[model samples]
Target chain A: MRSPHPLRARPIVIGVAEACLRCVVCCAVETHFCHVQFEEGFDERYTYVYHCLSAPDPASNPGIWLCTACHKCEEACPYETSPLRFIEAAKAEAYKRGLAPRLLTGIIAQITSTGYLFPITPSTMRRRAELGLKPLTTEAAEELRQIALKTGLAEPRGEP
Target chain B: MRRYAFFPGCFIRVRLPHLEALSRRILGELGVKLVDVENFTCCPEAVSLSVDKMSWRVMAARNLSLAEELGLDILTLCNGCLYTLRTVNQELKGDEELRGRVNDALSIIDREFRGLIEVRHFAEILIENLEKLKAHVERPLEGLRIACHTGCHILSPPEIMGFDDPYDPVILDELVEALGAEAVDYDLKTLCCGWTLSTYGSREASERLLASKLNSMRRGGATAIAVICPQCFHQFDVGQASAARRLGVEYRLPVFYYLELLALAMGFSLDEVGYRYHRVRNREVERALEVAG
Candidate 1:
């Protein structure tokens, strides 16, 4: 059975030992990487809380990764380590192994294809118009296209 | 005596009309006419690219194309919009195949992107027109403690934006000095407010970032923090309270777009330029009005 999380489709690897330690302690998400297996006082309820920096269980089905490059951990750590970086590295590994979320992948594909977050269409104009917006024209459009073509960005919508 | 096409970006017209008012007031005093190039749209925001780079660039390129039509260099006040315009301009200018592809995309919008116009942040214009700026300072912002917050999008990947010293920039400070305010020097001036990421998630992280900035400003003896980006202004002004709550400290640092402060020094009024839009309530602006008066 496939893992339910999109990150599960990818292979999450911990390449750097330093990164691994930071992730275990600082990340808000409990990646379950702790040696206190027999400890009875650990609060599982508060494990995911932003304030609690305790290490989590690393064996019980590994753990969930949730670091969003906020740099809070980096600022808090006495060692000046960046847990956010490790989380990103793990996410990249997961993505490489096809474990990354399909939704994120779709968004990335759309961005790479359209050079925009939203689909550009007349509907966009209609929505803006509804909002009482005037979608003004860009006079430099042709010149910018020439620059893009010369630079090898994606081809503008219409050109021989 | 030089003129360029002005793209005020969206925030200037709505959230921070002071930027529009101040820039025009000061620049007009300096004998520079900023032409609002007709038929221009949003420089679009960088957030769109984080969602989709292709459509962002294509649409952004469309805006830049408008500037090229009139054969004028682009002068922008909003840093986010400037970055968006310049990023697309750099991408298309540097890559031939990509330019062709984007141009092809532009054909659909009925625009032909030739990519000749040079995109510049307003700071660059100050750097280029330093002497002229000094000449127009009726009351240079002297004795005022002004800290600068240069947003991340303004300076990064150093090689591309050769406009100013990314690591140790003094253009804004110097401009502030020229306007009669003492540009309060401080550390962490180059740090990002994490405005882009913070608005989405990282609320705690974002607050922490702003807290750090406030601490720096306080340490630097800043009466107020001056910014070029509307987002930076929003983060530093509006986000300061939330950040203070997170850090468990009281931080009442005032933040203003550099233009607003410049307008104040240039003898504009609180009501004339709309000082009410600021997130943080301020008295330094009023003080400047008194000083100028």
Candidate 2:
């Protein structure tokens, strides 16, 4: 979403009020919320706890707090705002400064290196076929290279 | 003689062949030729948004590239595909700097994305060709009340979707009305069905969102709902059953992809529209057919 007025971009910061909202929505599970605890001292301190929602699991369990960027919270909010976007921006900043999880970083590397998320292993193909499904993609892997060329986003690795 | 590249997206061929077949039939009835761009990868909408921003743009651009090869605007039936392609097109169109950065990062694929082709939702096409749509209706869907669910992708993003009034869009509604059925106005018509989010998280949230949507439609006196997204169709139709079971409420609402309803009104059969694939049994549609007959 390009801002018509890019110069009008104010940094999306999490204020004390926003943090308070995040805290209210936070459950005892330490899922997705602001970790900054308001200390009794003059300075704010960061509290550390494993946000259990970030743990890896099979994709089926429904209760996990994997934020899917659907922007529903943004729409559903009584305040008409989103805490998740702010958190995402902060995470992006952290990653820019090299402070994100190794697993996440590794996954990014794999996707960037290979044109797939999980490897398109034979087992995965067989599993898909078992479901009476064919690959949904219209472009084959080789044709994908040609498409990449046309888009000018990338050239096939061997091509000049 | 006009042919636009058809992007069936994930839901059409794989999950809902009914919509694909119906769309093809309906479009053919309207004299619009749809050319399939086969072998297209998953839009990667679920994985890319959280994983890496560049791949999301690049992957969508790849699809757009295929469409551009045909030298026609990309006509998308799936709202997710529309949103995904529109997002990439918007990024490349509005921000040359971002386009260059994404293109450079995706250099391994031997591709560069140029925002050349027009990315249009099927709703948009109907809006553009409303006269043709109206003329194609052989059997008017009389007495049926259709509530249009445009979903989030085609609306929102004021910059990307500059064509429609995001908050109060009426293109789909107008198209629905053109088919000789009264397009019933309903509350929460623009609300997200929360399906994209459903792929990774709680089924509860998606159900809750569906309940909210159905509640709005029921309150508004809609007999049926018209959907453009397959995921939205799955959620509103299939998800409604589960939602009713979980929430302990009866939701008799029948959901149809616009193409299916349009094709039906154009004198096509329920089987032709792939009615058997739907989770929700549509007795009201049968009732409407009897009334029209």
Candidate 3:
């Protein structure tokens, strides 16, 4: 998330084959959380996404959706290439191809639809009243719609 | 008085208003004024990148510009918001081309990415005024040993976040100790709360991860778990109940969103901070409440 690293972080741009195989033995995300904690049949192995990226289709690894983008991989990478860059890149491609997890896609769609991840209903307002706070309102649609269009996440809604 | 555009990230703003309430009351009492800006959306959380990295950065820039327009530094209560806002602000400010591209997108909405202001996590601001905070402590949590979970976004890729030492963090612990509570050392302190996995990947896996974290805290003799992130708060508090229902196990460790703990120490009673809303309650804090009654 520091400057310059994100642009330079693309897996193919930085050469993932070079980053993942030899240098990234310390796949901290996997080593730290994934080994046995993952659900059944989910590959509990480390660098699962790296291996998936090396394979023909990059985003095939279920692990891609699993990364919180916490950047543990960025810290662990010996080359400082940020294995996270590759995961995110692959995730974008996966999303573009309609391969991202449904739950995650629903979440993104929720944002694109209302700008808020969760519904800002009367209940939320009632709860806020109890706290002596305000109702949160945003013109998120038009703004997010424009970005979604530019980023290829959605089509124009025929608005001016 | 320290002034900030309080960007109470969506999870807290929408679902957990009590956390918002406590944050506002505590910061206000401490002489920090929180300004709520208009038209601010969700911080867009972890999916910011994979959903479409460009839009992620663009959305984050839009939020930062809202604060920049006001010429105030943005303060975040949740790590997810901090991750998106702070990281994107720093990245765009430092990169000409990136800022230009984001600005190009902003042009669509009649805005610009000027990067005129800064972004920060609330804890950073609080930690800076340690002596003032120490003096405000009216109810010292003498025997309440706490396991501090800073959550992953506030740490990691030290160059990016730059808030605390990622590997050996002492800021949150120092915060706890300053409030007169023990910051208990436990295993897997730096591990992700698996909130991401629970939401986007595997519930069973996150539960297992939660089990291990709870086991570690119990072993470390913790009385409560203090989290600065809402996601981690939900996972530890709500996730504990869900995990118990599914796994036939109960680890009823109370979860406090650091600000609540701060309020308690600052002489605001538990009820004032909405302790009743916490899915899990601290028995020790409750016992003290009954004694006071």
TM-scores vs. true structure, each candidate:
0.67, 0.72, 0.90
Predicted candidate 3 versus true structure: per-residue lDDT over A17-123, tens digit per residue? 45565343444343344322355553425344455446555555566676777766556666656566777777775675566667676677778777788878899
Instruction: Give the TM-score (vs. native) of candidate 2.
Output: 0.72
- DockQ winner between 2 and 3, please give it: 3
Looking at candidate 2 chain B, the ten consecutive residues that score lowest on lDDT are B44-53
Task: Give TM-scores of the second chain, every candidate.
Answer: 0.90, 0.92, 0.96
Choose 1 or 2, whichever is better by TM-score: 2
Each prediction's DockQ? 0.07, 0.11, 0.48
What are the runs in model 1 whose C-alpha is more than 4 Å off?
A1-160, B241-249
TM-score of chain A of 3: 0.68
Residue B161, model 2: Cα distance from true site in angstroms: 1.1
Regions of candidate 2 where Cα sits further than 4 Å from its true position: A1-87, A90-160, B46-48
TM-score, cand. 1 vs. native = 0.67
Lowest summed-lDDT stretch of 10 residues in model 1 chain B? B46-55
TM-score of chain B taken alone, candidate 1: 0.90
Candidate 1 per-residue C-alpha lDDT over B1-293 given as tens digits, one digit per residue, 9 for 90 to 100? 67889887756544444566567766777676788865565575654233235656777887788889889888888777777788789889889998887777777657777879888888877767777766655655565688887765676434556555655667787777777777887776766665643543356656655666678888998877888887788788778866776677876677777766666666666655556656566566567556665
Give the per-residue lDDT of model 2 (tens digit) for A18-128.
Answer: 333432333211112121211111121222111312213211112212443434334334454554454444444334334444544544443334434344556545544
lDDT of 1 by residue, A2-108 (tens): 44543233233222222334333432322221212112232333332121222232111112233223243444444555444344444443443444444445444
Error of 2 at A134 (Å): 9.4
DockQ of 2: 0.11
* Candidate 2 residue lDDT tens string, B47-156: 33343355567777776776776777888887777777887887788898888876775565655677788888777778788877877788888888878887766664
